[model samples]
Target: MTDLLTIRGVSKRFPGVQVLTGVDFDLRPGEVHALMGENGAGKSTLMKILAGLQPADEGQILHRGEEIALRSPLDARERGILLIHQELSLSPELSAAENIYLGAWPTNGIGLLRKSELNRRAGEALKALGCDVGPKTRIGGLSIARKQMVEIARIHAFKANVVILDEPTASLTDAERDQLFATIRDLKARGVGIIYISHKMDEIFTITDRITVLRDGVVQGTLATGETDADRVTQMMIGRKLDAFFSRAEEKFGAEVLRVEGLGRRGDYHDVSFRVRQGEVLGLYGLIGAGRSEVVETLFGIRRPDRGKLWWQGRETAFPSPRQAIDMGLCLAPENRKEQGLVLGLGGRDNIALPSLRVFSTFGVMRHAREQAVYLTYRDLLQIKTTGPATALRTLSGGNQQKFVLAKWLCRKPKLLVLDEPTRGIDVGSKAAIHALIAKLAEDGLAVIVISSEMPEVLGVSHRILTMADGRLTGEFSGAAMTEENLIRAVAHHAA
Candidate 1:
């Protein structure tokens, strides 16, 4: 197989940061090349250069043995290159056909719309990926998986030779991910080169033909997927052996801080009963749609439980809103961090201080000195990489953004903390850091409840694990009983 694209000596520098340095990468026709790296490791920079979203300060991009200058996104697209970002760029109000042919809609003479031709062309593209969705269906009504397929269909419509999929399976279910893998195989059969960027080790090993590791704005090495293991790849990306990535410290739990009895929220969850102790790390594990989040939301007062009782510090209580929960020394870090957890346009100091502003305020005026002191404390503790405290939260990488979210709640000094998918979309190093932080917080006598879909995360950080299924607590395991097989069985077992 001949090389379809070759990148040599790629270097990019921002105002205050050097992104990529002397990087060399290549791709062959019909091959899935995996780009592996931690947050801020120049993977995104290299891909942006390839997609023409950004220019390399010094490098040469060769396509089909000919050097090409991709000065703009349109220039790259004209040469058969397409980049599908992690966040899908589909218009919600438009139908599948309209979105696929957005700027290039077929028009009759005199600028008249040719609806039939648009649908036919869109349908042909979708069918090529084994998708049966009607072209007239609205994009917003489609699942995340289907939306991704539509994006791939657009690539096919453009006759793209090189496709870049950034974190394609980040929000997909197991079955939907399998469908996407099938689609990728089809695209491979048609000789399309795929540049896959992901933090997921399993997906990379499963779908990619080769893996390229990048760290600290430089290339670590590129290895054949069949010849490498996850540990080796991880070591290359982080520059250290992660033998104890999931290690947990011994903990001695204190008195019960929270107790729930017959917690039921109409259609959401029912008969949920659990006890969280001080200095305890409780892990909640279950398949998606198993009411793990709903239970936490109800506990945090996001939803009212029609028939239930909560005992806070051994006293019966009710939280009608999140403010009430926060007042009662309980806080929740939601799963969807972008939408619910952090204010993107705001700076790190503003976000971390938002929840605990009262502490840094006098006579309804914020004390800038106090706020800065607190912000600087957490910035160092969490190792958040940012230009400054005033830098926009959106500018931080996923891992750093997550750390700021944790800092926001940690500043409040909550008695009980609920973390939902705390490590989702973060790199391996960040995941380990968050896991260690969770264990440390628990060891410091803070009651913590972790809700995660990753088995290793739950097993490694939690002193005990609780399994939920169909809106109810099904099983509890600890110590030697918290194996992956046991957890899966507990989640899979359906109760009458």
Candidate 2:
């Protein structure tokens, strides 16, 4: 069979890095080919070359056995090649139908907009993808999963020949992911070629026909999906066996670090009671909109509880603001790291110092040497890969960016840490590293709380697990009680 798209000997070079060295990849009609790698393994560089976001230093690209030059995104789109980025790109103020047909809206004889026809066509497109999001609904009002559905709907409407999906299910729930897989199968039936990039082993094995691994800016190897397993693929990507992707040290619990009794926030959560002890890692598991984040935000003083009491170090207290909570030795790594945790426009050193300026500043003057030393210390500790301390945070990979967020808070040396979805959108190696880091923090007698949607993650790093549903603490499990079956049942206990 003829290849739909072929990349031969592709190489890309930045100022001080050879991102891709003689990389070769291909996609065929009616196939889902997976691209797997650790963060900074040259996956994004290669994808950008394919999407015409950047030019390859050395390579040959062929479409239908004919050589081609893709100099811009428009050029790639002209050839029916579309890329759906992990970060959504849609106008929040516009309706779903308008965003779907932004560049090519339906028109009448005089080029006036045909609003009804546009909505109808967009609705049909969304229906084809098994999404029921209202066509006229504003994009800003939709959930992340629904916005993703709208992105996929645009591609379906365009009838793209070759589609590149980057971390497509990073924010989706199980049900939404099933709907996406159905859409993919439908696209395959129509002979659309797909290049799927994800860190999830199950997702890769489930949907991909072939797997290609990239490591240190070079092609490791490609294997037929049916002929290999995750262990082999992970080994290829990281050059080592991850015998235990998650681990925790044996540590004795100390005094209770925090205690919440009958916490309630109007229209958010109510009667949420939990406690975390020193040298303990508590895992909070819940589906989206289950009010997990809301509960944590309240603890960190981002939200005030209308009812209930909080006790820190056995003393009942109230934090009226985040600064007060921080002063009291509490820190939170928010769920949306990109928007809330770190400033992408700043350099790594500046971001790491943003929250702990007092530690680096003396008598109202910035202490550059102390700040630089701290940045280097945490950079080595977290294994943050970057060109220099001055490198923009935005240029770093998702894993490294997340690590910086951790470094920022860890520098504060807080007594308790709240991590919301700590490993979202990062590679497997980074996930394991972060999990180990969490365990290490707990070993040092710091109370840690991890909020995650991934079941395996919640089960692995957490010493004790708490489940939430519809803003209520449904169940708590420890030791023998911590099983997937019980956790699943608890998460749905109060679902409406």
Candidate 3:
């Protein structure tokens, strides 16, 4: 394989933080190069530089045997580079054909909305990628997997020589992932180089030819997939041996803290029945679309289950809204902290204390002194990376923003907590801190329900685990029964 692109001594610094420091990396033609790192390890920064979205403070990027200055995405696009971000960017109302040929449309002598021609071209593109999206169907009506297929189709439409995929299968099922791998294989057949970025060790081993590991804004090492195992690759990413990431916690149970019977939400969850005890961490295990999120959301009052009974402390409760759930000692720290969990436009103090807005107010006026005092306590406790409480969420790193999200919910001091993928994309340090907090919470006799796709995380913090399939509970296992093999078998059965 020949080097299609090379980055040398790349460095970038912000006002007070060094995001990337003297990094070196490369991408080869017709090869799938996997990039591995914990969050905040300069992976995103390096990709941004290659895509021409951000400039580096000091470095050289070589393309096709020439040192080049890519000022913008258009400049990179002209040089055959396409980046597919974690967040999907597509017009929900637009059809597949419209989104595929959005800006650079093939127009005739007199430009008009070309329907038949657009649909035919889009069908060909989708056919090439093995996508089943109707060219004229609105994107809003498509499933997440199908929409992702459209995004891949968009990449194929551009005919880019190099493609950057960041966490492409994070939100996909087993079947969807197989389909995506097929698409990648087809792309590789056409000699398109791909940079596969993810935290999934199994995925890198299965699909990528070579793997590059980064730690603390530096290259750890690069090894061929055939020569390295997942354990070795993980050790490289985290700088230590992780034989048991899913920790074996002590088993302690208290009185029933939360009980739900006959829970039913139309088109979502149905006939859900469970009880969470104090001093216990209940793990809800499922595939991406198996209604794991819906069950928790319904419990948190984000979605009201049409026919159900909720009991807290042996008393019936009616939670009409999230506020009601919070009032009853139930709260949720959502999965997507950047969007659903925190307000980027607001300062850290405001975002943290936003849930408890009523407490910081007297006669309908928010008091800054009260808010700042509370923020100070959590800032030190959570060790959030920020200049001050007044700093905006946007200015902080992804890990820091997530810390703030957890801080906000902690301020509520609820008894029953619903956490969805508590550490989706964070650094090792942050992950450790959050795990410690969870242990402390369970020790304090707080009822905690954790839902995570990461098997290690689920197995780490839970006293017992329940597997959900489609919309019903199918399996339940204790800490003793929690092994990688057993867990996979349970989820696979549910999927069937």
Candidate 4:
């Protein structure tokens, strides 16, 4: 019953922030421990310390009754501990076998690489994790789910005793997640301990044995998963009672804001047609690579349609570029917020003002005061947490980054808004706020389109739901017909 690893009195501090304070954690063999926290609740700090990415200001880590010094990630890995980050760390151009044994490749006595042995070992490791991917397959060519499998296979190959997985299922599909759970169970049977960190309540309750909650850099408490409920866990993390997670307003559809007829983008999506009405939220639901994003991208002029027609307020219109779409009163907050929406090096004020610069400028002269006022308005409205308006966007958490992306498009006062994976990678509290904001935007008469992989989100926020599969619209449902079962059936009905 002895713990495999234990953290005692851990503390970490930055210039203006105390990220962790007297936090303690433990991991036992064959156990999956859940780490729960809000966006800025010091969970990442603790994990980084465990992985030896950064040294704790004051703390001690014990392994099997003996204190240990973890000076670097290499030290931790050598001790049979591995951390799989939310952002995957893999060489995209390398083959699966090469990446599996990246720094520790097999070699012959003459110092030449042993390709056959390497591939055989990699294939065995992948098979142990129940993955079917070929060892010679390129890492970049694999899907996110397959890439995750490869990551797990690497851990198995390394014989890691303790594995730290951060948001492991963030981008995975339902089937892929089930596969991952099977792999986790296999690891558990093999006596490996897992440290799981995620914002999803369902996942935590389903997979974890014990739950530890952190708030404001301190440990609130730890409880056995079977003995505690989600309500208690949420209260512990946020120190407040959360209102209903999903807040949907009354449905009141207005005149059609956009109508697409037979929209096709050759290899991406084809024959996609839908209509969005003012003061209504249209939810697009599908599996990954289901052409949902492509449809919205075409509408926002990010992709040109090979054959189709778009009608804007009853007038046939064609937007050759995103700028043209913006000029025509349409804006898209893309799925990859960091890569496609915000400039990480820029400050919050600058990012929110980027899309609406013309509104604050006159005669090609910049208006600092006006821009600041607009930025402050959105900063307050979106409840963006930052030390100052000038703080770099990269310094903010994932949730706040998403809020900034929303503020950028909201500031434009566009007639139609397209939000793709708007709540991906955000915490529960932030998700509720964003959901409420989406409802409010629709209430205020802005046509909205939300493309999300989360079924609950799509069902809760949309007045209507459209299902896509294999680059085409498979089905549409609304009102009482939009259950999860029906949505899944619709997506699978057109499967190739």
Candidate 5:
């Protein structure tokens, strides 16, 4: 397998930020090469350069052994290159077939768009991508995994020799991820060169042949996958060794703090029953669309449950909105952390204190110094990397922004905490810190519920794990028995 793509002396810079500099990279035919880095490590920048999403400040690109200047994705396509972005690009109203064969449509004998030809090619492309979505089904109704498959199918339909998947499995379930990996393998077998960008060390080691690490706008190093472990990769990305990231903290149980019975939301989930005692961490594990989020949302009053009874500290209650839920000492950190977690344009301190602004208000006058003090506490506590409490949330890294969101919730000092996909986009170091913080909170007698798609996460932090499939509680796994294989089997057998 010769080099199918090569980047030499690449560099990029924004107004106040120099994102990438003097980067070198190459991709061989029939290989799954991974890109690794922390959130601000220039991985996205380099990928944008390769995909023509952004032009290089100074560099030369060689595709298929020929020097080329790609000004747009269409130009890159002419060079047989395809990019599946971390943020998906699919029309929600369009059908899978329409999305796949969008511009280059095959026509019928009558010179009109051929429906049969569209479905046939779309179906074949989806099959090769290991996706089972219906060709004619509307894209909006499909799961995130299936939508990602649609994107991959569209790229595969182009028959590009060089394919780039940027964090493609970030939102997918384990089984769905395996299906994606299988598709990558098939592509490699068919002589397509692949660039896989991810922060997940396990997946990279398992699937990729080689890896390139970027840090602070420079190439850290490239290493063979067989020659490194998670620890080494972590060191390479950060230029230092990290400590242990998980701890099975001793949890103390108190009286039931949260109880739900016959919880049912119309067209969502039904008859969900659970209780979380003070100092308890309840792990909710489910594949995408498995109602894990719906159950929590109902608890948080994001949606009205069709039928159910909820008790806070054994007192029957009903919340019609998140405001009511917050008043009752409950908080939810939603899935799209960037979108729902923080106000991007606001200062980090302001975002952190926004949830409980009234607390920092004196006689209807806002106390700026008070909010600053609170932000400084969490800024040091979470080790958030920013200029100061006054820095805009958008200027911070993804992990730091997440910490700010958590800080906002912490300012409220809620009795019941609901973290949905809390560690979704964070790196290993931040993940460890967050998990440890969750455990510490639980030990202090705050009832906690963690809704996650990550198997290891559910197994790691929860004393009791509830498995959801579709919109129902299918099974419950105990603290000691929640292995990866069992969890996979449970999800597979019960997933809707």
Candidate 6:
């Protein structure tokens, strides 16, 4: 079959960064081609050029063997190209049908709204995707998974020939992800070429026919999926093979630092209990809506618990607010880092110092030198990549952004640290670094609780593992009992 789209000699540059360098790629009809790379490896830059969100400094694009210029997003869309961003792009206040037919809603003879026709077409699109979401339901009221389905249905309704999916499964449950895979197969059968961009090795291998690797704004190589294994692709992505990526020497545990009993929040979680000790890493494993994050948020006092008891530092305590929890040496690096953890407009120095301003100030006066010193300390320790401390947090890649979030809390020297999905959208290289960091933090006698959707990650980093299902603790494992099989089984144990 002839290639559907071709990109040759593509390159891009910013003020002080060369984002892409002479990148060459192509896509064939009916193919799921994966674009794999580290956080700053130029994947997003290339995607932006294709979507006409930005112009390439130097490159040539061709469609059906004829040169083409995509000067705007409309040009790309007119050519049957669409992009689904990692951060969804649907209006919250609008209903599902309205979002699907947002710009080009059906109209009558005098430009009157044709609500029935719009709903009928939207219902067919949703039905084709096997989604039961109500056509008139508000987008804000729907789950993340359902919102994604609506996005896909929008693309389907447009009959897009080329689709770019960036980190599509980052927030989906296993069942939802399976349904998405089925949809992808259907699209592939219909000859819709897909540019799949993700950091997940499993998804890439499972769905893609070809794998392409980029490193530091350059194309490394492309390989047929059936002929290449994950280890080889990973080695190409990071310039080296990862051996025992989660290997660590076991450490001895200290005295208990945190304990929760009969924790409950109506409609969120119930009867959840667990304990964390000094110098111990406790792993929490569950599906997306399995109450893992809700339990942690309650523990950090983000939400009031209906019934529960918490013991901190051997004293029965209640944290009615996050400030009280932080004052008690309990801190959390939340799940959604951009919205909940960091201030994007602020510089690295400011974000790192935001939570610890009290320590650096005296008599209501600022101490720039002390703040800089602390920022530099954690920046170097975490290996955060940036031009300087004054660089905006949004300018950094996902891995470095995550490292900064860790720095923001690590400088406070909290007694018990809670991490929710620490490596959710980062690359394999960054994941290994975080796994190592978790082990080192435990060795230094800090109590840590790691909550992850990936079972391998939980098993690799934790000294003990706890599984939750339907808002309750289902199983606990340690030593020889911690296995993927057992974790999967426990995660499926729903409440009766």
TM-score of every candidate: 0.93, 0.97, 0.91, 0.93, 0.87, 0.96
Q: What is the lDDT of residue 19 in candidate 2?
A: 88
Tens digit of per-residue lDDT, candidate 5, span 151-178: 8886678889998898888888777888
| Root-mean-square deviation of every model | 2.4, 1.8, 2.6, 2.4, 3.6, 1.8
lDDT for 295 in candidate 1 is: 90
**Every candidate's lDDT:** 0.88, 0.91, 0.82, 0.88, 0.84, 0.89
lDDT of 4 at 154: 76
Candidate 3 has a TM-score of 0.91
What is the per-residue lDDT of model 2 for residues 320-373, given as tens digits with 9 covering 90 to 100?
488888878899999889889999999899999998788888997999999999
- Tens-place lDDT per residue, model 6, 1-496, is 7788899999999888899999999999999999999988989889989998999999899976778999988888889888887767899999999998887799999999899999899999899888889788899998877888888887777888999999989888888889889989999999999999999988999999999999999999999999999999999999998986784537688899999999999999989888999999999999888899999999888999999899988889875588888878898999989879999888899999888878889998889999999988988898888888788888778899999999989988899999999998999999999999988888999999999999888999999899998888899999898998889888889321
Instruction: Give the CA lDDT, 0 to 100, for residue 471 in model 3.
Output: 76
**lDDT of model number 4:** 0.88
Ranking by TM-score: 2, 6, 4, 1, 3, 5
lDDT over C-alpha atoms for residue 31 of model 5:
92
Better of 2 and 4 by TM-score: 2
Best-fitting candidate, scored by lDDT: 2
Off by over 4 Å in 5: 101-123, 342-354, 357-377, 386-397, 474-496
Which of the two candidates, 2 or 4, achieves a greater lDDT against the reference? Answer: 2
TM-score-better candidate, 5 vs 6: 6
lDDT of 3 by residue, 1-496 (tens): 5588888999998776788888888888889999888777778888989999999999999886689998998888889888887767789999998888777667777987668888888888888777778889899898766787788787778888889998888667677789889989888888888999877767888899999888868899999999989778878877887654544345677889899899888888778888999888999988877688898888777887789898888888774488788887788888778768998989899998888989889989999899999999988998776877777887666678878887888888888888898877665556766787888888888889999988888888888888877777768888568777777877777321
Candidate 1 scores a C-alpha RMSD against the true structure in Å of 2.4
